[model samples]
Every structure is written in C-alpha cells, then in structure tokens.
Target chain A: MATLSIENAGKSFGDTDVLKDISLSMDDGEFLVLLGASGCGKSTLLNMIAGLEKVSHGTIRVDGEVVNDVHPKDRDMAMVFQSYALYPNMSVEKNIAFGLEMRGVGRAERKAAVEEVARLLQIEHLLDRKPAQLSGGQRQRVAMGRALVRRPKIFLFDEPLSNLDAQLRVEMRTEIKRLHQTLKATMVYVTHDQIEAMTLADRIAVLKDGRIQQIGTPSEIYNTPANVYVAGFVGSPAMNFFEVTLERDGDQIGVMLPAKLKGVDTPYFLPLPAGGQYHSHIGQPVVLGLRPEMISQATTAAPEDPVITCDVDVVEPTGADTLCVIRLAGRGAKARVSPAFACEPGDSMEFALDMSRACVFDAETGMRLYG
Target chain B: MPQPKGGSSHRTVLDKLSRFLPQLVVAPSFLLILFFVYGFIIWTGYISFTDSRMLPAYEVQGFRQYFRLFAMDRWDVAFDNLLVFGAFYITLSLAIGCLLAVLLDQRIRAEGALRTIYLYPMAISFIVTGTAWKWMLNPSLGIESYIRGLGWESFRFDWIVDKDMAIYVVVIAAVWQASGFVMALFLSALRSVDQEIVKAAYLDGASTTRIYLGIILPSLRPVFLSAFVILAHLSIKSFDLVVALTGGGPGYASTLPANFMYEMTFRRNQIGLGAASAVMMLLTVAAIMVPYLYSELRGKRHA
Candidate 1:
C-alpha cells in the first residue's frame, strides 16, 4: 500500500477546464471516495491518479515519489472498470494471468497466483470458461481477479459496481468493502452513487461543477454540509430550503414561517438555536437548511423542540418512513414522519422542527451562515 | 344466413390468394436459376462423359475425356500455374490488407481520403485492373522504358512477356484489386473491437504490439476466416484477369485452368475435355466452401 497525493492538480481539454486546482491526499490503507454527479470531474481525477490521463497543471506523487512521467504499468496501479473490461477472447485463468505475464512472472508463480485469486473470488470453476460464458456477477469477479493477481500498490475502481443489477450491486459493494478491510490497500474509488460513497469511503469528497464542495466523513457530510449544494446533493429526499428573514423576537432570534396558526394572518415564528453565529444578522435574508428527518410528526417532538402546523401538499410512503411535502415560509419543504402517522394531502399536520440540527445559509451566496 | 355464407367464401378465396402471392412473385427468378444454373451444370456433367468435338454429341464414351485432359501437356501447365498463383495471391493480399488496416486505424487525420484512395480500385472491374497492369508491365511502353529513359538502361520490368514470370504478373494484378476490399473488411472488424480492452491491456504492462498480437488479433479470427474464404473463391475462379492481361500467351506458358478450358472448348474444338476441366474447378471450390459453411452455420446455431 502507498499514499497518493494529488497537489494543485488541474485538467483542461483545450479551453474547457474539467478539473481545476484540485488537491487531495490519501494516507496509506485509507479508502477515499470521490463522489459527484455526471460530468463533475470525479472520474477524470481518478484517471489522473491511475496515469491513464495526464495532469495538465501539477504533480501527482505516490509514496513520496513524483510520477508525472511514469507509465501506468510502471506506476503499479490496478483498475476495475465499470464495464468490467475483461478480455473476451481469453479464459478466466489467462485473463487474470495476463498482467503477471506482462510483468515477466514465471509460469508456476502465475498459476499459483491465479489459483489463489480464483479461490478468493469464489470463481475456480470459471477458470476454464471465457468471459462470454460468465454471468454479469461472475464477469465482475473475474475483472476483480485480474486486478488482484498483480498485487499493485494502489487499487482504482471507476464505478465498478454500476453495471450490476441493483441487488447484485449492493452485494458487490459489501464485498468490495470487506476486501478493502482485509487487504488494507490504499484505494481511490470514483462513483456518482452517494450510497456507495457513504458505505465504502473512509472520507467522502463531494464534487460539483469541477470543484470540491465538501470533504468529510459520511455523517459529517450528511449532518453538517458545507453549503446549500452539499446539503442538497448528499442526502435522499434532499434537504429542504426555506427562504426567510431573521426576526429579533425579544431576546430570541427566529425565522418567521408563512404557515397560518388557525385562521389568522399572523406568521409562525420558529426560534433558532441559542447563540448562533447569525444572531447579529437579524432582519437579513437567510435560507434555512433542514433535513427531512429533522422535521417529523408532533407526537415524536421533544419538550424543547419548536413546532409548526402546515397543510400537507403531497405524501410519499417509502415503507420505513413516509415523506410529507408541506409549504413553509412560502416554499415547499419535505418532512420525514412515521408511516403510522396517518396524514394525506390537504390535511393540516403539526411538524416538530429540531432547531439544533438545522443550518442557515446566506441567501445570496448560498454558503452556510451558522456553525 | 345465405349472405353470411357468401361473405365467408369470399374471405377464404382472398386468404388463399394472399398466401400464393409471395410464391408467385418469386417463381420467375427461381425457375430461371434452376434451368440456367443447375440444369446447365447437369448437362455439362453429362457432356464430360461423351466424346463431343466441334459440337456437342450426346453419345457416351465413359472417362475418355478425363483421360485425355490428364494426358495433355497444356492442361498440366495450367494446373501448376493455378496452384502457384492462388497460393501467392491469397497470402500476400491478406498480409498487405491487414497491415494497411492497422496503419489506418491509428486515428489519422486524412483517414477518410486515404481509405477512399485505397478502396477505389475495387470499384473498377477486374478486367480494367488487368488491362491497366498489362500497360504498366509492358517492357517497351511502361515502367521498363520509363525507368530506362531516366538513364537506367539495365531496368527490365517485362514480366508480362517473360514466359516463366507471366503468371506472377496475374497474381500481382489480382492482389492489387482485392487487397483494398480485404482492408475494408479488416478495418470494420478492428473498429468494432472494444477499445476499453486495449486500455486495460496497456495498464497490464503490455506494449502496443503485444496488446494487438495477444488480445486484438486473436479476437479477429472470424474476420480472418471470412477474408480467406472470399479470397480463395476469387483465386480459384480467376478467368477474366488472365484473359485480359496475358491472353494465355508467350506460347501458352502462363495459362490458368479457366483460360485452358476456354482454349480447348471453343478454339481447339475439344468440348468434352473442357467440360471435364470445368468439373474439376467446381470440385476445388466445393472443397474449400463445404467445411467453411458447416463451421460458420454451426457457430451461429450454438450462439
């Protein structure tokens, strides 16, 4: 295993900059996942580390040695592609042995290595069969076997499980995590799936529009997202954003919600957490970032929780939790409640908002305002 | 009830006509092929057993023409030339075509124009190719005199007139006309190869040459079989090229089997012997085609 450091790395195709001023470093045996939507430069960054692509700006050092000019094979990295890119003409044994043969390994050693990998991957029976003869999952195993036989310094997986079926994808995802733990190899995995990043990565780097938006542990990224984009991109059912003006109500600072209490024209005031950084910004516009789980049925509310009542616009039952869309502060917001909480569209329901977990962002800049 | 019976009867007649329409449309061409192609083959087979000369007389003298065809010195020379020409032509064309295709697949800038230039000769008839090569190989008129004019007095490119070398001239013309078509076949096959496999091989530490030989070329076995089958048939039935370029001349020194059959049938009035030669040519083509067809069809069935 080796530490990989990408320093001030940038890539440009003619005039279009795909990745700009990106700097990331990994400790030995650390799993770093680069997560983003499509066209967000995560795959390009992974390719640069693998030497499949050249860094247009800065140096990439592996194990403290600059490898900008090194060939990919000499750099000693193994990659598993999304397509599983197995050589179709070769039997599974030969496919796994091809890299070792290219590295000039002896026949007996190559055979032993192939046998070991085949047993580890549970594919010994598939050794004599060609890639076309294998199922999708079997082919994925062979692709991994081809990479593992060489015992490279680093493992690079470019959306390797994306091509499998949903059920098989989760199974392989767990297997990859288990393998990473057992092998203790420095791995850099690139994927657009947030769940994969959350489940596999030691630290997740969320990327957007060719820039790193946030880099943290999965809970840190999900709980305290750096900005509105990170808040929205990293979660299922997405964090709700409420555009509201901060009001100084006596000694407490709070945001006024547009929901009515009974039949009155008065707006509901939900108090912010005590002593937030936005205390001095009273009467300024800010976006309140609240995850769906932060708002729930009033029955589950703690005594200190702030409560508000709103008309439900839509309800989506996802088995474990029912997601209710309600209007607050003149914008749509999602609330996660128990499926047993019987409510429908056009029904008035009381939702308890957990103030401590909610974040406020600057309305104009979209940056988080309070720590 | 009577009106309903009449409507049902009308519908049945229309259905019968619809079923017969496709067969009716195909019958003319099918009958024409059966009479002209297969019928003539049977008639030719029968005539080979008779002693027909100057005209076809259908009185059987069994195996007489085959004995005479085997005894003739001209027939021996033609058979020998076919073996030499077919062997060299198919091998050289396949090698040259595959090389050109590999070169073109290198993401070249002017690839469209270059591919068209290579493939333009295939658009012209084989007769045109033979005539062009005939002019180019003429000692007094073409490359020989042209080079001699530039003060190289020892330049001698008179392969067209050289009795011992004239058959190779036919091989050259055939290779030139067909190699580009073969290149087109190979280029498409190369294009269809999964590029990610090459990238994976590169990361595996294989050089560009090794990647192609070990992975890419092995996957192109089907294309190789296809090119071989096509070139084989073209070599066996090579008639117009020999006729247009050499005219079986320099005292019948470079005569191929087809040219020999023509000379015996129409020119020397040895019709029965010509039929026997034609039957031999058919057997040679069938020997190549039968196994190829069986294997190809069997592969499709398994797939």
Candidate 2:
C-alpha cells in the first residue's frame, strides 16, 4: 500500500490541453476514482499515474517520493486495462507469472505465485488456457490475476469492466470492491460510467473539460453538487431546474409558484430555506434545483412542506416508484411518487416540495448559489 | 400490362442467362489453369519415368532417370548449391526484413517515402535484380574496380567469379530483392498488434526490448510462418536469378536445381533427368507449403 499524490498536474497534446492544473492526493489504501465523460482527460490522468504517459508539468509522488521521471515498472504499479490486455500468446499461468519472470524471480516461485493467484481468482482450471480460449469474464479475471501476482505498491485500473456485459460488469465491480477491501491497496481507477464511480469509489473526482469539477464522497457529491454540471451529470433522470424569481415575504423569503391548477390561476408560494447565500439577490432570476425525490405526493402535508397542485403531463411507472411529469414555472419537472399512488396523465396531483433539500443556482453562471 | 407468353419466355431466358454469366466468364480461365498447370504437372510426373531424350518419348523405363539424376556429380553440386542458397537466403531475408520493419514502425517522419524506398526493390523482376547485382559483383568492372580507383588497389570483391563462394553471391542478391517484401508483410503485422498489450508489458517491469522479444515477436508466429513459406517456394523455383547472375558458370558450380533442370532438358537433351529434378522441386515446395496452408485455412475457419 502506498500514498499517491499528483500536484498541479497538466497534460497538453500539441496546443490542446487534455488535463489542466489537476491536483489530487490519496491516502494509503484509499480508493480514488477519476470520473468524467469522454475527452475529459480522466484516462490521460490514469495513464500518467501508470507512467504510460508523460506529465507535461507538475509532479507525481508515490509513498512521499517523487516519481515524475520513474519508469512504469520501477514505479511499482500494476495496471488492468479496459481491454484486459492479457498477452494472447501466453497461457493464463504464464500471463500471471510474466511480471515475476521479467523481474527475475525463480521458476518454481513463479509457478507457486501463479497457482496462488489462479486459486484466488477462482480460475485454476483456466491456468493452461490462452486468452482467446477464455470467456470475457475469465479474461478479466486473468488480467486481474496478472496485476495481483505482482503485488505492486499501487493498482491502476483503466475502465477495466467497460468491455464486459452489463451483468458481468456488475459482478466484476463487486469482485473488485471485495478485492480492495481484502488487500487494502491504493487504487486509482478511471471510468466514464457514473454508476461505477458512485458505487466503487471512496472519493470521486468528477472532471469536466480537463478540470476537476468536484472532489468528494459519493454522498456529498449527490447531496450537494458543486455546480449545475455536477448536479446534472451525477444522477439518473437528472435533477430538474426551473427559472424562479426569489421574493421577500416579511420574515421568510420564497419563490412564486405560477401554477394553473384545474384551469384556474391559483396564487401559490413556495418558501425557500432561510439563510441562503443568494438571499440578498431577491427579485432576480435564479435556477431552482430540485431532485425528483425531493418532490413527492404529500402523504401527511406537514406545515413546513409547501404543497402545489399541478396537471400531470405524463406518468411513468418504473416498478418501485412512479415518475410524474408536471409543468413548474413553464418547464417540465419530474416528481417521484409511490407506485401505490394512483395518478394518470391530465390528472391534478398535489406534490409536497421539500424546500430544505432543494438547491439554488445562479442563472447566468452554472454555479450552485446556495441550499 | 400483362406480357405476351413469348415475351415472358424470352425475359425468363434472359434472366437465367444473366444468372449464369459470371460462371460462363470464369470457365475458360479455370479450364486453362486445370489443363496447363495441373495437367502439365501430371504429364511431367509421367515423363520422369520415361526414357525420353532429345524429344518427347512415350516409352516408360521406371526410376531409371531418377537414379541417373541422383547419381550425377553435376546434379549433386546443383542440389548442394540449392541447399546453401535456400538456407542463407531465407535466414538473411527474414532477419533483415524483421529489423527493417521494427525500425520503420518507430513512428518516424517521412515514413511513406522511407517505406517506398525500401519496398521499391520488390517491384523489380528477379532477372533485373540478378543482372544489376552481377555487374556490381563483377570484380574487374564493378565494386572492385571502383574501390581500386579510390586507391584501394588490392580490393578483391570477386565472389561472383569464385566457384565456392558464387552461390553465396546469389543468396545476397536474392535477399536484397525479396527482404523488402518480407519487411512490408512484417510491418503490417507489427502495426496490427494491440498497443495496450505493449503498455501492460511496460508496466509489468519489462523493458522495451523485452516487451518486443518476449511478448510482441512471439505473437507474430503466423507472419514468421508466412515469410518462411514464401521464401522457401521462391528459393526452390529460382532459375532466372541464377542464370542472369552466374549463368551456371565455373563448371556448374553455382547451378541450382531449376537451372540444372533447364540445362539438362533444353541444352544437354536430358529430358527425363530434367523431369525428375522438376518433380523433386515441386515436392520440396509442397512439403513446406501444404502444412502452412492447412493451418492457415483451419485458423480462418475457427475464427
């Protein structure tokens, strides 16, 4: 196990900067995931950590020692690639034993290590089989086995499960999490899949356009996204945004609900959480961010919860919960309701908006304003 | 509108003819190859056992020509030259070709121009290659005289005229002509190798040399087999090169099997002996090619 620190790392290919001023450090045995969409430099950062790509600027340190100029092999890191990257010419046993042999380990010890890794990966029967002869999952296991046999200081995975089928990906994801728990090794995994990042990482560094958008725990990122991009990029079905004009109402500040319930103009007011940073910007436009779960059927209709009746445009049942699409301030807003709650398109339903859990963002700049 | 019965019949006939047109177009060439290539091979096999001399003779005298061809000292020398030339040519060509391929694969600038420069020799006919090398290897007229003019008076690059070393000169010329083709084949195979595998090896603590030698080169087993098959066939059928370069001179010292066959059949009127030698050359090529083709076809089927 080792600590990995990348300080002010930047990479440029010709005139285009692929990663810019990225600084991140992980403690020993920490599972840090670099998450981003394509062309966001997540994979480039992973390659730099693996020493497969050179750092154009800044320093990479491992175990508190500078490894900016160290070769990948000497850096004592083992990597599992998205393609599995198992040597096609070698058998599973030889594939796992290759690093040891290259490092000049004795033949008998190499064999023993190979056997141990095969057993650990539950691929003992595949020891003599070539990569082409193995299934996708088996090949992934052998790739992991190859890295594990080396027992390196840090383990780097480059979207290793992306090539697998959906079911296999989930199974392998769990297997990798279990492996990390058992080994307690520092792992830096790069992935474009938000689900993989959310489920696997101890701390995720969400990247956008070669810059870190936010670096926090999965819960922290989900509960409080740093910007409009982070909030939109993280969740499935995404958080809804509505143009709202903040208004001061004596002791409380609130936003007007321009609701047309039952074909009648109803005067409605939804109170904003008190002490928001953007409270002084009343009467100005701000994008109100409300997750689907934050707006549901009002079961008890508590005094603090603001209830608004709106015509449901569409109703989609997704097994456990039904999603009701309704118009909120001239924009489509999705509200999650219990499957048991009977509702249909064109039916008016009262959704209790949880103002405490909602977020506000600046309309011009996509940065989050306040809670 | 409904067509008349006669017009409909004509249209059906035309459609049938159009369906059969591709096969009709290809039939003549197919029959020509069957008769001239396979039929001639069978006829040659039959003639090898006959007592034909000076012309085509129908009388059979089984194995007599074969025994005589094997017994001749000139034939023995020709066979020896073939062995030497084939071994040296194939080994040298593969080595030089693989090295050139590796160097060219280094993402160099002006790669297209450099690749064309190396590959240009493969476009030249073996006869042209032979004649060109012949002038260069000629001691008094070529490199020897040029070097002597440069004040090296005792320069002796006369392998073309030397009896023992004449076959090696053929090896050198043939390698120069064919190694580029081999390099092209190997370069394509090298480019197709997965880049991630190389990176994985690098992180596995293997140096660049080790990654290539231990991982990359071993994976190119199919290309190696292909190069060997092509070189072996080319070596066995070599005639124009030996003739243009050495002319089977120095008392048949540099004569390969094909040259010996041509000399025996046309020049020396030993038709049966020539037929026997030709059949032997065919068998040698088949021995190298059959297993390779079988494995290649089988691999394709499996894939």
**Poorest lDDT segment (10 consecutive residues) of candidate 1 chain B:** B1-10
lDDT of each: 0.90, 0.91
Model 2 C-alpha lDDT per residue in residues A207-259, reported as the tens digit of each score: 99999999999998898998888888888778998887888877688787776
Local lDDT at B115 for model 1: 92
DockQ of each: 0.74, 0.76
- Cα lDDT tens digits, model 2, B1-303, are 999999999999999999999999999999999999999999999999999989979799999999998899998999999899999999999999999999999899998898898899999998999999999989888999999999988879998889999999999999998899999999999999999999999988888888888889989998999899889999999999998999987778999999989999999888888999999999988888888889889989999
- List pairs with backbone clashes in candidate 1: none
- For the candidates in turn, chain A alone yields TM-scores of 0.96, 0.96
Off by over 4 Å in 2: A249-251, A256-269, A298-303, A309-316, A324-333, A345-350, B1-26, B300-303
**What would the DockQ be for model 2?**
0.76
Name the 10 consecutive residues with the lowest summed lDDT in model 1 chain A.
Answer: A257-266
